[model samples]
Target: MNQDAIEVRGLTKRFGRRTAVEDLSFGVARGSIVGLLGPNGAGKSTTLRAIVGLLRPTAGDCLIDGAPFSALENPATHVGVHMDGFGFETGITARRHLEIIRLAAGAPPGRVDEVLEEVGLADDAGRRVKAFSTGMAQRLGLAAALIGSPRTLILDEPANGLDPDGIRWLRRFLRGFVERGGTVLVSSHQLAELEQVVDEVIVIKRRALFAGRLDDLIRNDVDSLESRYFDLVEGAQA
Candidate 1:
């Protein structure tokens, strides 16, 4: 088996005249959590979508565990994904939504309740998705990701609607995931919150700008991640 959880080589994406990502390459190690950091319109979402096979890359390849996402024998069992603005059926109950995914993923029957409790949504299991709060809906998305017991998790802006307490819960949950040999690739515009949870990060400005250990980037830097991020991005633009 490949040691890297994910590998992107010479990745490029274009939309008409706009080049969203260009020749991007990086590897996420096994049993680690890495953050994808970029300013808005910097192609982070496009890159993530391509990695999960939601969007075909204009050039190059994204490999998960040494194979293309579509080439995986049972993709759901290997990768869990939560894209930004992920959708659910508004009229469907949370439990039913998860049950549907469980069936599709071929997971065990009890997996729905297990993930509901895991995300602290068991009480809202019967609640219609349309009635859910933003945080509750985010939890439901996370529950769907956890349903297949995947070894690698890909989440885009997962902290968008989370409160302080919910963010804390996410921190713990992701830490536990990496501790148990799972790999996590989380993309977020919130640098401070991401700084708290990531071991390393890949920073991009429509291309690969920096990819290294988080401690290395922060070392000898007095400013917080937000400040440093501005400096890096502004310098790149200049």
Candidate 2:
């Protein structure tokens, strides 16, 4: 198995005449937490979708564990992904939702209870998903992604709708997860929040603008990640 959790080389995606991502290349080391940062329509989602096999890349390839992700025999065990929306059954309780995913992924039943507690959803396990607030739904989504104990986690805007406490919990939880030898790839417009937890950052503007450690991205300047993000985007436009 490869030590790199994810590898993308010359990735390109086009929607008609617009190029969403162009020649984007980056590698994520195993057991590290990396943030994917970009403005609206900066191809952050496109790049993530391509990596998780949600969308076929027009060019280039995405590899997981040193092999083509598309060829992975059991992708669910290899890569756990949570996108913008919750894939919940509204009428089902949180426990039931987790039960379903655990069974579908062929994971052990104990994992269901474990992840619910991990995301602070065990107390609300009996509540129907329809009654969940946006924050609660986001927590449920995270619980689902963690149920199978995947080696790699790809989350797009995982912090969406989370309250201050929830965000803090997520940051700490992600740090713990990475500490335990898991790989995390998360994309968020909330750079400030991500900066608190991400070990490295891949900043994409019209294309691959910067890819390096978060501190290095701002090493020469004392500006915050958000300010540096804006500067990178503006420089791309110019």
The residue pairs found clashing in candidate 1 are none
Deviation from native of the Cα of residue 206 in model 2, angstroms: 3.9
TM-score for each candidate, following the candidate numbering: 0.97, 0.94
In Å, residue 133's CA in model 2 sits off its true spot by 0.9
Q: Which digits, one per residue and each the tens of the lDDT, describe model 2 over residues 42-157?
A: 88888888887778999998888877778887777888889974478899999999899898888998998899889998899999999999899988988889877888899888
lDDT (Cα, 0-100) at 163 in candidate 2: 90
- Best prediction by TM-score: 1
Kindly give the stretch of ten consecutive residues in candidate 2 with the minimal lDDT sum: 215-224
Residues 26-112 of candidate 1 have per-residue lDDT tens digits of 999998899999888999999999998888999999999889998998788899999875799999999999999999999999999
| Cα-based lDDT at residue 50, candidate 1 | 91
Q: TM-score of the candidate numbered 1?
A: 0.97
Candidate 2, after superposition: displacement of residue 11 in Å?
Answer: 0.7
Error of 1 at 19 (Å): 0.3
